[model samples]
Target: MQGAPGKRIAWLPTLVAKRQDTLRAGHLRFAREAPWSGVLHCFVLDCSGSMLGGQRLALAKGLLIALFDRAGASRAEAALVCFGGAGADLRFGPAVPRWWNERWLRPVGGGGGTPLASGVRQAAQVLELSARRKPAQQRWLWILTDGRSSDQPVRPRHADEVVFVDFERAAIRLGRCRTLADAWGAALFAPDELIA
Candidate 1:
């Protein structure tokens, strides 16, 4: 119980040692890392031409960063997939949200056609790989779009959960987002639900 002048065996509890008026560092020990059982949120953003003028893309990007923060706080993983005229691009990952903020999102621009199917498919591929590695991990696919794509919806294989966040706001709503959600048996949400 005596290594130095003030060193004493206080109490071996809660993995910490408390002396009279100070908490010394010697008794603060660390155990093994805890196992993580969390859902991986794969955000599929529609960076098409329709999302240009209204700042819909900007809103989506901001929401994505918030979601990233939420994922990090929850100790969950996150990914970002952007799709447009050409095809879907995996901007972020099936990786941890290490640098998911405004800085990382600023460079991601919107244009081209809305390849909704492509984005979902690309995110599904990432989910498949993640599934093989962390088989017990749950996967969520979040599609942020205005439902303007003419491409047929194809449900991704590895997504355990799905949500279609409709960004549409027009007189004659095409309701393609509802169609996709129906196809996947997923929940439907508006963009504002994120902030809430």
Candidate 2:
């Protein structure tokens, strides 16, 4: 639809969908289905000091590898944003991670503050960019954190769905992840719950 004109026309669906909008110069827009419409899984990981103390970061890394592997098999794309210390950094791509493995994530260390807001903000940027690049592709945000942060960031509006993977294992739980999930209407799961 972007390049080729007069391509395969989804007539009825297009007409029905576009009925609300006014057409220009009585010219109909032909719509063609993307040859491969895949999903993009954006992960926002917390690499804070609290996560490291309980081996939560280690477990989260393991889970990332698994999820990346799944995305590869499904022919989907993935991105990784890691937050710790004072800021958040994009560690991986918004493209298909064909070369994903433990080696790529083994060096992801944990330290400093949780910086949950920074992590979510960085991920929101990624999701917004992905939405522009692949408007038809579905986007899912996966936030893996220990709920050790005091920051409560706004949820990314571009994400079609969101998931909160809680990694809290402390004797005294904060339950911040659960609160975020409830507020955002996102699916909540513990690391163990996901594994099983």
- State residue 111's C-alpha deviation in candidate 2, in Å: 0.3
Candidate 1, poorest ten consecutive residues by summed lDDT: 10-19
What tens-digit string does per-residue lDDT give for candidate 1 at 1-196? 2233333322222121232235556654332133475568898999999988678889888888888887776667898899988899898877788666799888888888888778888998989988998887878788889999888867888887787778898788899998878777777778785475
| For model 2, the run of ten residues with the poorest summed lDDT | 10-19
The TM-score obtained by model 1 is: 0.80
Residue 181 alpha-carbon offset, candidate 2, angstroms: 0.2
Measured on C-alpha atoms, candidate 2 has an lDDT of: 0.83
- Per-residue accuracy of model 2 over 1-196 as CA lDDT, tens digit each: 1235555553322332343366442435454445466678999999989888768899999999988987887678999999999999999999898989999998999899989999999999999998898788878899999888999899999987788889988888889998999899787777775563
